[model samples]
Each structure stands twice: as structure tokens, then as C-alpha cells.
Target: MSAALPHAPARALNNLVTQGWNQLARVYNSPVLQRVAYQPPQDEIIEQLRIAGIRRIADVGCGTGILASRIQQELAPDLIYGCDASVGMLRQAQARSDQVRWINRQAENLGLDDGAVDAVVSTHAFHFFDHAPALTEFHRILSPGGLLAIVLNNPRSRFARLLQPTMVQGLAYFPPPDEMRTLVEAAGFRITEQRPVRRPIPDQLVPDILTVARRG
Candidate 1:
């Protein structure tokens, strides 16, 4: 049986997202897309984990496992699980890393054990998820005191803010930083750090929002 009318919107949104990403899976990490898509601050993520002493990382919405590969190389986490909804993306990810566990899974329904991941990281992908269910899953899989860091496109950005609707076919949204912090808190997290990346206001800035929280 399908979901009721109230839940239908979310279901439709998920379907659209899945379809859109699946179609783009092959070219998602291509040079053309890379120039257009805003990327998370990889060096910053590594530095933060170094400071926090985090291991056993889970990279949600890990498109082609690019960031996951970096983490495996830099931090060499004991367990790095990379999950994405697109099968094509997962196939490419598997081709890249034999160490990282590449799973074909959605954000809201991660196939991971409870308290399995020490830190959950979603980079430039949270805006594409069903917030409530995905956040709940993040809370569920993370250990007590585990960190949650999400990177998203800054809605204030000239490019992302204005051109997202034309670029992506599905229901896409970039919430304000404050609203995001509240959502994470509602999912049983305590906000630790929330800041803007590529700040100092660059001329052609790909502004991003990074929010770090802890499960308590």
C-alpha cells in the first residue's frame, strides 16, 4: 500500500530526487558539473575530525565516493561507509575504493547498525534529502556523543540561490542556516558549530553553510 495523502508529497519528492540523481549519476562528478556544483570544504572537514579525534565515519549521500576516498586517504578511519541512492554512483565509488564500504542506500533509510558510526558527514547533499526522516536516521545510527556535520549550499549565494531551480529537476531547497540548526536540534542533536565557508566574500563565491552537531 502507498502512503496517505499527507505523506504523498514527501514520497513524490523522494521519487523525483531519486530519478533526477540516477539520471545524473554518470556525469555527477564530471568537470562540467564540478564547476557548477558547490563542493564542501574537504580540508576543513579533515581538520575538524583531527581536532575531535573521530573515527568510523559515515559519508551520507556520498556521490561517487569522492570525499570518502579523501577521508580514507587522509584520516584512514577504521570504518568509512559511503552510502548513496544511485546505483551508477555506487558502482563508480566501488571502482575507486576497495576499503570504503559503498552501499546503495537512501539518506532516510541507511542500512547501518545502531551506534555504528562515530561521525556522520553529509556534504553538499542535505538539501536533496527528506529532512525529518534523514535526520532521524542520522540520530539513530550515530553513537552517543557522535558528531554530525552537514554541508549545504548557502541560499544567499548568487549562483545557488538563483539558478538551482533551473539546474535541478526535483524538489530542491536550501534552508537558512538558523532553520537548519533548529532542524538538527529537533532531531536530537546539540549544535556545536555553524558557519559559512568561502567567506571573506569572494567575487565568484560558491558560498556554503557547514553545521556541526553532536548526538546527546
Candidate 2:
């Protein structure tokens, strides 16, 4: 029997994710979708930024620039870079604010200088990344002791768990909180906080989890 190709599934999933997001970019910020999928975790991320008092930050996988625009408006960070792999997404983001320097880049290859930002925030985006290299990139781009906040779907309900495999077909793999913490630590970050975001819609089965770490 031929040995299984371990990386093939991951590579295929990455391709699907990239294509799906590019196709979804036009309608991604539609009000109904935003309300259900984007707003809650976004609010949580902003709160995290407030507590951290980050002066310079990068919003990785910043689709449509909603969170980055909000950060620019609310926190008034000294510098804000919105980075994403999809040109379609970056195009939408550019229209949100000229203040944000939007760049077309993957999470694993941000093309930024070392220690370029004080904080890196990625909301609802981590599951789509190549975890290890992406975390390595986050570490490379962060100043020493810089904060990294990642918000992602962490299903706890039986209904959600049952649907996870189907979702992974289109959405890519989402690591559970413990696995995520291990991955972050292995990438040289010190875990500071890992908690579930209060679900805005109580019936929402796939809730978001926030994992905050600091570069050592």
C-alpha cells in the first residue's frame, strides 16, 4: 500500500480556504453575516487591545478591514497594518480606511521586518492558517513581550462537534484550546489568557475562543 501523504490534506485545505475567501470577499461584510459571524469576537478583540495599550499593531487575516478600521477609530494606535492573503479581501479593506496600511500577504509570510509591531491580532482567522509557520511569523514580527491575540471557533456543543468534520471540509482545521496553547508555546509565546468569548447569540453552538500570548 502507498504511504499516506500527510501534508496533502493540509495543502488541499489551504487551497480551498484561499479560493473560498476570495469568492466570499464581496459579500463577507453583509450586515446579516457581520452580525452573526464577525461582530461579537471583534468586540472582544478590541477590548483586549484596550487592556494591552498597544501602540503599533498588525491585524493578520484582516478581511474587509472591519476590525482594523475599528481599532484605528477607537484605539488610535500609532501604526496599524492590515495583512491578508486574498487580494479580493485586501481590496475591500483598502476602501475602509487609508490610515490602515493594507498589505497582501499570507500569515506565514507577512513580509514585515522583525519586531515591527507591538501587538498582533487575528480574529476568526487562525483556523485557516498553517499553524506552526504562521505562529513563527507572528513571533518574528512582534517586539519582545509583544501580545498576540487569536480568536477562533472552538466548538463545545454536541451539535457543533457533529458538524465540525463537515465544516473542516470547507473551513480547514480548528484546533481545540489546549492544542492551540501548545502550538503557541512551541512557537515561543508565553500563554497569558485563554477564554471563551461570551456568545452574543446564546444559541450559537460554535462559540469563539480567545487565546492571548506574549512573545518571550
Candidate 3:
């Protein structure tokens, strides 16, 4: 189990995450970052979404709406909601396209009705969330059998593990595959698939794990 943060530390961590992302919002979509961090797992995420036959979807921690925009163009989901806590990030996302409904909200309180979406996709953003509450919220907003895809950094190397704690200062947590499966299942979801995202270059230092689940 992941260690629980005391109230003060948790609040501080939340502020740090929000502030840091807000600062990065402008340059977050730059090509360099996209190539290294964002683009690689996109195809797989979209494929999973397609396989799930999603019509209405929510992109939690959507960040600049890159994936959401792609889904809008490719899958052409009936409704697309892009949600993020950072106003700056949401602003950038809003600029991408008017088609997506941009909502300024955190993952734990998405402000959507119960069972409101067919699928929820969050990439490279789950680490910054309060996992248990966020997972519970994800389950709450998803319909029975609703699909969920989460892409996040799950460091495995000794070097990566050593650095992980100091890097995010308790603001982010990357649970390994076994722990992640437990967390997801505990939230009332059945694990459908779990795999490592193939990156352009090998990235053993900080690998991305994709976990897909269906609400039971």
C-alpha cells in the first residue's frame, strides 16, 4: 500500500502540483516534450478507447487537450469533456478546439453526474492525484461496464526508484503494477489489461504503464 500523507503535507503537495502544472501549461504541448513523453502512448490509448466502443468520454487531467482533440477527430466520440485543475492548462486546452467541453475541475471532484460517461482516459497525470479518492471518483462517474485507461510513470530501476521520492516531494506517487492492480480493483473495477507503453527509445529509467479496467 502507498503511504498516506498527513493533512498538511497532502495540501502542500496539491498546491505544488497545481502550481507547477499551471506554470508549465504554455510550453507543455511543445513538440520536444510530446515526442519524449506524450506521443508514444497515444496510439495505444486511442486503440483501447476504440476497442471499448466509447461514445461519451471524459479526459481527466486532460492537460492542453491533445489526446482529447485527437479522440474528437479520430474516434469522433459523441461527447468529449476535457477536465483539468489548472486554469492555465485548461485555457490552453480550450484554445485547441471549441469542440471539447473544457471543465475546470480536479480529478477527485469531476462535477459530473453518476455514470455520466462511457469511458475515462487520463494519461501522464494520475501520479499527481490523490489515488484512492480519485479512483473512487472515477468509478462513481462511470457507468456499469464503463472503461477506464490510465497511463502513468511506474519506475522500476533502482536508480529511478531511488530518485522518485526526492523528485516529486510527495506530490506524486507512482505505484508499481501489482499495487496499481490492487488499487483499481479496490475501486470496484475489473482489470481488463495491463501493459507497458512502447516508447520510441527504450526508457527503463521511468517507464509508462497502461492500466485498463472496466467498472463492475
Task: Assess each prediction's global lDDT (C-alpha) against the native.
Answer: 0.78, 0.84, 0.84
Clash pairs for candidate 2: none
Check candidate 1 and list the clashing pairs. none
State each candidate's clash count. Answer: 0, 0, 0
Off by over 4 Å in 1: 1-10, 31-40, 163-170, 199-204
Better of 1 and 2 by TM-score: 2
Score candidate 3 by lDDT.
Answer: 0.84
Query: Considering TM-score, where higher is better, how would the candidates rank from best to worst?
Result: 3, 2, 1
Q: Judging by lDDT, tell me the better candidate of 1 and 3.
A: 3
lDDT by residue for model 2 over 85-150, one digit each (tens)? 776677788888989888777788888999999999999888888899999999999999999999
Tens digit of lDDT per residue, candidate 3, span 1-216?
A: 002211222244677787788799988988988988898777788998897788999999898899999999999999999888777677788878889888877798888999999899999888888899999999999989999999987766553666566356887777888999999999999999998898887767448899999999
Better of 2 and 3 by TM-score: 3
Per-residue lDDT tens digits of candidate 1, residues 77-140? 8899988776656767877888988776778888689999999998878888889889999999
TM-score of each: 0.85, 0.88, 0.90
